[model samples]
Target: MTTAARYATFGVREAHGVSPAYERLALAVAQDDEVLALLEALPPAKRQPNLLFSVVRLLGGPVEEPAAFHDYVVANWPAIEPEMRTRWTQTNEPGRCAVLLPVLAALPQPLALLEVGASAGLCLYPDRYAYRYGEHLLGAGEPVLDCVATGVPLPDRRPEVVWRAGLDLNPLDVTDPADVAWLDALIWPEHTHRRARLRAAAAMVAADPPLLVRGDVVDDLPALAAQAPADATLVVFHSSVLYLVPEPRRDAFAELVRGLPGHWVANETPEVLGCDGLPEPPSEAQHNVLALDGKPLAWTRGHGQALSWFG
Candidate 1:
């Protein structure tokens, strides 16, 4: 696709799959040269759909209209350049807690959870957040998540997460003010609910942080897997993370999981794993396909707002 076409497609997809506010901004950026020029200023490698939106939000630009947003970008170009150069698109969405609740509840209790690509380790504390799936309510805490469920019965009890650790290429510490602020900046502008939840989750994590190690997930899985206690069920998982892994390495990571002694759970694009028995995800929008041990389980919204269980 041409540059304009790519941006347009991104805008439409984000509108359908992400947020309507981002959709407007993306569409505007596609048509306005001045706005598009600001995006072009970033490194080609950094020109992701989320990058532009994240930068604009970080700079406190309005979410609507291309021209005014363009002026803001131009006015703040000097200040924004350094941030764009150093920051990556890393959103620590705790809303995904809702999507993982059912899967965790179904898993063997007292699990030693290992999450690859766990940014800020917000997802590590599934038991710490409350969830509502239809009429059934689970967890009792400050950060409550509501999800729509289908196809399978919601698990009645929370998984006993005995131990949890996370692996990330760049792990953010929830206790660090700057790190936490960046995570907030990555959130889309109109997602006030999400932003609020992120703050609550960060506070919870700050009070009791999980073990987050920085390393290449594929290269470090075996060692980390070994560190998990043998008495507990090792539940290796990841959400929206493998897209960053190159094809060969992703395959290697899958092979490593297959060789491990416990369950492997993943929420990523269906094609990322190239596993069998998984149907093609709906092409209308981006969906995170949830799977366990290579078998497709369900489809979920990007940030876990809803779940359609196939298992």
Candidate 2:
């Protein structure tokens, strides 16, 4: 798809209900040839709406109004282009832990988690946060996550995570203000709750940082997996991480993980994993396919707002 098509689809499928500001901005960007051309100059992967909008937000540019946003993006193209080139759209949403909780809790007694594309390793601390799975609350803490789930056995308790680590091309440090600021910017304009959740999650990780390694997911996975305790179930997992990777690389990573001991949990867009025969998603809104050991189990909202299990 062209950049314009991607932006239009994102506006409709992703931001329509979640973020009005983003929906308007994305639709406007899709129609603006000037802006589209500017985006076309960047690498294909860097042309993502999330990257552009986040960079603008990060640089204090306007995203609420289309005209102003366009002008600012063009005016600041020199600065924006460089940032987009260097940065990846690592939206480390801690809310996604809600979707993973059910599967993680069902795994063996203790788990050793290794996350791919773990920007700040916030998802690594699922045991640290609280969750509200539609009236069935689990744990007690700040930044409580809420998700509407159906046809799923809600976890009775959080998993006992004995070890946790993350692999990213550029692992973000939760303690760094700049890194945290980038994370904050990646969140949609209207998601104040998510911003608050980010702070809480960041602080939690900062208090005791995980072993976040700066390396390629495929090349560096085995070394990191080797570090996991043998006694624990080493569950290698990733959420919204594979789409950025080329198809071949994604397949290679999948193969490598399957060969390793323990389980594998992947929550990604159906197309990302070439998933076939998935039941119809619960709604028209964008939903990722949640699979365990390459078996599709549920359809999940991007930010873990809801889930529909059809295992």
Candidate 3:
């Protein structure tokens, strides 16, 4: 069957209680001649698949990023096999970890950051001016924040970040308006506010594009992690990017980071299990904020984006 068809079937079956308002995917694979042709193109391993497709099926609503990939499947089903296309669930929600805000407060001065899998880099440049923290406001019209967080002490004039960069398998170069527009369009329309924030950030980056690289995390992790300044609290962070990696590969990458010297904070899913037959799906998007010694400080998500305060 076509990849979309397979995923559609899986999603339809899972909708019972997984997501109340999930997308309703179709299972017209048998009827579509294109599906058979697509299935024929699959390697023996994928064609003999049991539940990989079933795990990521679509239901109830439109598949996220339909604009970037839907038509590609419809027009080229024979060329696109089930294994190549995956159903992705976009996660752009801010965190609710209590330790995070307090960590931000402890910065000694302005700072730098590096975000891996920074799809469009909006959250990477989180300090572009004003933000509301319940009744308190931070950054007061600053052109993005240069925050250098610590375990204690919320002070102004933190460390000066010599740089801020990001790495992604598919990096978004906002200097090109077309690319920026495409990234903006990729965002689901339901998230109007997020779309707006992404647009504003895109505009800011368009003027001064952030340093980005398109590469594999396995190969790029070491170099990127090593780039952190010694005096600076080097933070190698990512959001919702770990699910795409294999367990062994993910473990290897995390081990490499832990071995590095600096603050290694990775915001990944906490889900260490639940892939069923598929081996890549993570357990949960745990908000991992670690100290320079490679220690996890908290875990959470919400208004403050705090998960837990181990401190």
Q: Which portions of model 3 show Cα errors greater than 4 Å?
A: 1-101, 104-110, 141-160, 272-299, 302-311
TM-score of 2: 0.99
Over 1-311, each residue of candidate 2 has an lDDT whose tens digit, in order, gives 99999999999999999999999999999999999999998889999999999999999999899999999998999999999999999999999999999999999969999999999999998998999987899999887998999998998999999999999999999899999999999999999999999999898899999999999989999999999999999999999999999988988999999999999999999999788977788878899999999999999999988988998
Using lDDT as the measure, which candidate wins?
Answer: 2
TM-score of every prediction relative to native: 0.91, 0.99, 0.60
**On residues 231-283, what C-alpha lDDT tens digit does candidate 3 reach at each position?**
66666666556766768977787777777655566544345322222222112
Clashes of each: 0, 0, 44
Q: What is candidate 1's lDDT per residue for 1-311, written digit by digit as tens?
A: 45566678878765655677778767777787865676677666466667666777766776676667777877887877787777767778888878877777777778999989888999998878888877888779778887877775687777888899999888999889889878988887778888889999999999999999898888887888899999988989998888767789888998889899989999887768675675655456767888889888888877888888776
lDDT of 2: 0.94
Give the distance in Å from residue 77's predicted Cα in candidate 1 to where it truly belongs: 3.7
Q: What C-alpha lDDT do the candidate models reach, one value each?
A: 0.80, 0.94, 0.47
Which ten residues in a row are the worst by lDDT in model 1? 275-284
Q: RMSD in Å for candidate 3, one decimal?
A: 8.4
The residue ranges of model 1 lying beyond 4 angstroms of the native Cα positions read 1-3, 33-45, 275-283
